[model samples]
Target chain A: MRETLRYVASRLATTFLIVLGAMILLFALSALVPGDPATALLGPAATPEYVQRFIQEMGLDQPWYRRLFSFMGNVFVGNLGTDVLSGQPVTRIIANVLPYTFILTFSSIGLAVAFGVPLGCYAATHRGSLLDHLLAFVSVAFIAIPSFVIAIFLLLIFAIWLDWLPVMGAGEAGNWFDQAQRLILPTIALSVGWIGFIARLVRSSMLETMGENFIRLSRAYGLSNRLITYKYALKNACIPTLAVLGMGVGRLLGGAVLVEIVFSRPGLGRLMFDAISTRNFPVLQGTVLVVVLIFVLTNLLVDLSYAAIDPRIRRQGSR
Target chain B: MNPDLPMITIRNLKLDARTEHGPAHILRGIDLEFGRGRIVGVVGESGSGKSTLVSCLLRLLPSNIERLEGEILFDGIDLLKLSPSDMNDWRGRKIAMVFQDPMTALNPLFTINTHLRDVLKRRFPQISAREARERSLAMLTKVGISDASVRLDAYPHQLSGGMRQRIVIAMALLVEPDLLLADEPTTALDATVEAQIVDLFDQLRQDFSGSIVFISHHLGLVAELCDDLCVMYGGTIVETGPVAEVLARPRHPYTRALLDCEIEDDHGGRLATIPGEVPSATWAMDACIFASRCAHVADICRRGPTVLETVAIGHKAACKRSREVLP
Candidate 1:
């Protein structure tokens, strides 16, 4: 138990450093955008005096380092400033849409794992068969196609052509059935490529694990093929898959940006898109920071899970 | 299950492995028998099909096997004729195996407890978890593992190589298999550990009445532990006899060469090595497989296939010149 505690503590320290670095980098990159926030918000028709007053009011008139320090200071105190266009605190805007993004990301990943792991395992065990080849071909095709392209195609076929689902937007809040119905197309669009990616990963890893001496021993012991493949082989094979899945979370989040825009859904991706166009640096910085934190935390969880799955790693951590 | 009958009999067994060049004949017309309660040692260098023979016993041949024709009659029933599911039932319950590298034998992701308990549960489906644990703990203690209860909870990675090997032996023995196939069980261990494991096998002989087929490259180990010995060369048994008789008077040139290769502390000269490489497994032999490397190679050896000829009571050699070659 103490070893676990030390392991988690060390991982948390690393996560903190990663999030801080991402925050600093996000601030610097946003500052480098070639547009003045005041000008973008006020428009060309606005008088120079109004623009000057707006700049001073929002503290854009301060030097870059001071702005960065104040931004960091405000973030540390749980304040993300106001959106210039909406006139709402950036934190409130983020909090409102965070649930939608979380639903999309988690549900899509859950779907990917549900289908990918089994398909990959089947393909590996039946290697060189026609079905295995077909799965291989289909997975490669899906992986080669970008998620946005898939989203557009799915949107066209399901919403526009078939008229089977909503054309846009996350469904009405508090209505579980309608919300799930709307989530179908976007989730499918987002998860298809990931399913292919994960399947390919699991296929290769399972193949390698099956070739291990212990797996052969399991077979020699007369364990059923299903038990050996799913339980014995998959447990060891899933280690690499877990690490990849952690990184997949970040990729899926980035993919959600385009999917949300294409679907016109209310999410951090859509918020960031609007903020980028309006030069709303505070909202953009806040959203990016949250995404970075989620990515780092998921990866930390993945690392800790390695200890849970493999005793060799657990012993190493204790040492 | 007549107690007077031999435990297992293998007849005219042949196996071919698919290689890039074509099919490689891995095992060529093997004939052997194991009397009840006897320990047989099969010794050969790498590529001599010693390991393949054991895999054949379990029907665990690799995917590249092109053909396998044989009768593996375990107590009058042919193992090769059984369906896969039936074979599975026969595998752990009737015949268990111990592999060469214990370091790689047990799954690293599982605790020794899980490894032991799972095997018992699989063999005896109605066995309670508590009973399985107790049986496993008893087997561990029987295998000379101290603090067996505590060791059960430890993962395989936490144990030393010798300890893991003992656990593997414990697992095999716990099933009370009628036949135990051990493929170089101590080849991966240090000299001291190897001796200890050998002694453990000696101790197991007292309780384990089942037949054992021990495969190894170490001639000394086989001479010390086995009641019968089979000398293999070029994927075929070159000689077989009572261990004492074979070691005392090897009837085949290859067997003589092998015994010479064993290192002795009093030897002052260079280490003895058999001349020539093992014949390529891909070759289709119509003559003596060892003709190219045998010191006593003659025109007759290259002219026709060699078959085992009786040298004495319970002794045989594949070489036609067995009587002249005997030292």
Candidate 2:
């Protein structure tokens, strides 16, 4: 227990340092971009004197190091700076979009697991069969195309061509059912790639497990085929697949950005995009910081879960 | 004929399997019989089809295998004729197998109790949970596991290699199978543990009325533990005899070579290795499989697949020159 605690403490400390470094980089990189925030916020029609006045008033002309220290201090105390474009708190903007991105990421991951794990197991069990070959072909095809292409295709098929789902917005209207329906297309787009990767991972892992000595022993014991595949083989196969699934969470975040853009959902990806185009430096910094934090935290969760799933980890931890 | 049938009778069992090269003839027309309460040790070098023969008995050969001809008669029933699902019921109930590597034999995810419970439940569905626990503990104790009740909650990983093997033995015997197939069960354990497991098998024989087919590459272990010994070479049983008689006089050249290679001491002297590899089963061999490596090879020894002719009471050898070869 103590060893696991020590391990987790060390990991969390490293993640904190990384988040700190990332935030600094986000601030520095945003600052280095060749654009005056005041001029961008004021638009091309603003008089030169007024632009200069606005820059001074907003403290855009402050020394980079000084401004950085202040921003860091505020962020340390849970204060992301206010947006120059809307004059609203950056945290509030993130708060509105963060939930949608979370929903998109998690739901897609759920969808990926729902389809990927079973398909992979099926391919493994029915190796050399037509179904196995078809699954293999589908995984390779899905993996080859980028998430955005899948997003566009799904949008075209379900929204434009089929008229089965709404083409725009995360339906924050009507009932909970409507909201869930709105998410379906975006979730499918984000998950298709993940499902392919996870299924392939599961298939290969399961094949290896099926060949293991314990599986043969299980068979020798007269275990039902169902018990052997679902209980014995799948249990072992899923350990490695769990790590892959966790990694897919972070990968899904990247894909979710493209998916959100295609679906026109109010998510972190869309927020980041709008912030970048308008040069909304504060909102951009806040969004990037939140994304990094989520990535680090999820990885920590993944690491901790290893100890729970495999007792060998716990035994090693105790040692 | 005796009123009670033999526990197992394998007749002209031939097995071939697909390999990278071609179909490998693994088991070639094997004939074997053993009665209840007897321990038959199958001793052979690698690729001699000792393990393959056991797999054929269980009908658990790899998917690539093609059974050319065989009838595994267990208690007068033809196991070869049973459907796959029917075979499943008879597998753990009438017959069970213990593997060489106990670490991989038992599921790492399950507790010892769970492993025993699973077998017991299938065998005795009417038994309640409390009674099942008692039966599991009793089986563990029968296998000489100390603190059997406490050990029940432990996972396979928690136990040492020897303990795990014991658990596997316990699980196999929980259903009281009529025939137990132990494929080199002690090969993976230390010398002391191997000895202990062999002793456990002896004890198990008295307590449980079942036949055991123990396969191993260890000739000395087989000589000491088995009531009956069958020596195999190149996918054929080269000799079968009472254990004492075979050790006293091995008729087959391959069995003699295996007996010579048995380690007897920690001396720093050279250890013996059988000359040449066992013939690959993937190709057709028209000559004697052991002729290339046999020390006493002669012109007449090249005939394909020597027949097992009786050389003495209850002893048989495939060597045509057995009378001359015998010391």
Candidate 3:
């Protein structure tokens, strides 16, 4: 328990460093986007006096270091600055957008795990049979197709042709069915590849684990293949899956940007994309920082999960 | 002894395994039998097709390696003809197999208890989870594992090599199998542990009344542990006899060479040895398989199919010149 606390403490420190680094990078990158935010906000024809006054009022008159310091200060105090256009705090915009992305990410992951694990088990157990080959082929096909291509294909079939679901929406319809319908295409598009990726990973790992002494030992005890697959192979099979899934999380988020665009959902991806074109410095920078924070936290979660799943990890961590 | 009663019969067990070239002769015309409760040892150097022979018995050979024509009868049931689902049932219940490398055999992610319970659950459908747990603990105890109940929660990585082997032994003995097929079970273990395991197997057989087909490259272990012994070469048995007789007076030239290579504890004035590498089964051979290595080369050996004859009671050797080869 004490070891867990200490590990968490060290991770917290690392997370703090990550937050700082993310903020700095976002600030620099946002500043270097080629066009000035002030210019974009003013738009083409403005008198010198009005431009200078607008710039000063917006705190563009301040030194780079000074602006950065205040930005960092506001961030530390849990106050990300407001969006210049909406007159809404960056935190509020993010809080509203985040849930859409979060739900999609979580739902897609749930789908992948539910489908991938059993398929993996089946393929590994069958190995060289027709079922194994067919499953492998399907998984490979899903993984090979681009996510947008999948999104468009799913959109074409599920939305355009069938008319079973909406093509695009920001969950604006308020009805749960409408919101869920909007999610289906994007979620499946994002998740289909992950299903393949995770299943392939789980299968190979399961194959390896199945060869392991304990598995053989289990069989020698007259254990049924099903019990051994679930209780032995599945648990042993999780480490590689966890690794692939942890890496997949970032891809899922990045993939969501394109999916969110096609579906027109208001997510951090869409928010940041709009912010980029408008040169809305605060929103763009805030989104980048949150993404980094999410990434670092995800990594920490991976570590914690690793410890939870394997006793060898807990023992190593404590030592 | 009924002398004629072969408890487990293997008739014309011909296995032609696939290779890069194509079907390699794995087992050719193997007709052997094991008496009830007898310890049969299969000894050969690496690549002698000893491992392949046991794997065939279990139907555990890798998918590509096909058993062409064979009948493996365990009591009255034709094992080779059983379905995969039925094979799973037969395995560990009727015929249990233990392998080399205790490290690789047990699944790493699970606790010993989970592994034990899972196996028991398969064989005993009516066994309650609690009963499985109880049975697992009892089995562990039978294998001489102390604090059996406490050890269940422990993972494979947590246990010593000796302990792991014991656990595997405990697992194999759970249903009290009619036959136990152990393939190089102690080869990966340290010498001391190997001795302990061999001794444990002896004790286990006494209690369990299960016959064992022990396969290994270590002829010493086989000589010490087995009652009946077979020496395989080029995917076929070159010689077989009562262990003491075979060790004392080998008939097949291949067997002689194998025994000749045994490391002596004290070199008299010179170390004794043999000169040859085991020939690959994939390489087509039209002569006596041991002709390439045998010191006594004859023109008759170059002819196909080295025939086996009962040179002595309960002793057989597959060689054209078996009469001259033996002392």
Provide the TM-score for each candidate, comma-separated: 0.96, 0.91, 0.89
Q: What tens-digit string does per-residue lDDT give for candidate 1 at A206-242?
A: 9999899898887778888988988889999899999
The iRMS of the candidates, in order, is 0.9, 1.2, 2.4
Most TM-score-accurate candidate: 1
Which portions of model 3 show Cα errors greater than 4 Å? A1-13, A28-69, A126-145, A149-161, A203-222, B1-4, B263-270, B283-285
Compare candidates 1 and 3 on TM-score and give the better one.
1
**TM-score of chain B in each prediction:** 0.97, 0.95, 0.93
Better of 1 and 3 by lDDT: 1
How would you order the candidates by lDDT, starting with the best?
1, 2, 3
What lDDT does each candidate get? 0.89, 0.84, 0.80
Model 2 chain A: ten consecutive residues of lowest lDDT? A310-319
- Cα deviation of B147, candidate 1, in Å: 2.1
lDDT of 3 at B12: 81
DockQ of every model listed? 0.78, 0.60, 0.58
Model 3 Cα lDDT, one tens digit per residue, B44-68: 7777778877877777766676546
lDDT of 2 by residue, B1-327 (tens): 353777889899898887788888998889988898889999887888999899888888888875558788987888889998999888888889899998888777767787777777777779888898998898888898999988999878889999999988988888889899999999999999999999998877877788899999888888878899999888888899899998888888888777768754357755667778777787576777788888888888887757888888889988877788765
In order, what is each prediction's RMSD in angstroms? Answer: 2.0, 3.0, 3.2
Which regions of candidate 2 fall more than 4 Å away from where they truly are?
Answer: A1-18, A24-69, A172-174, B1-3, B263-273
What's the CA error at residue A15 for candidate 2, in Å? 4.5
| Candidate 3 CAPRI category | medium
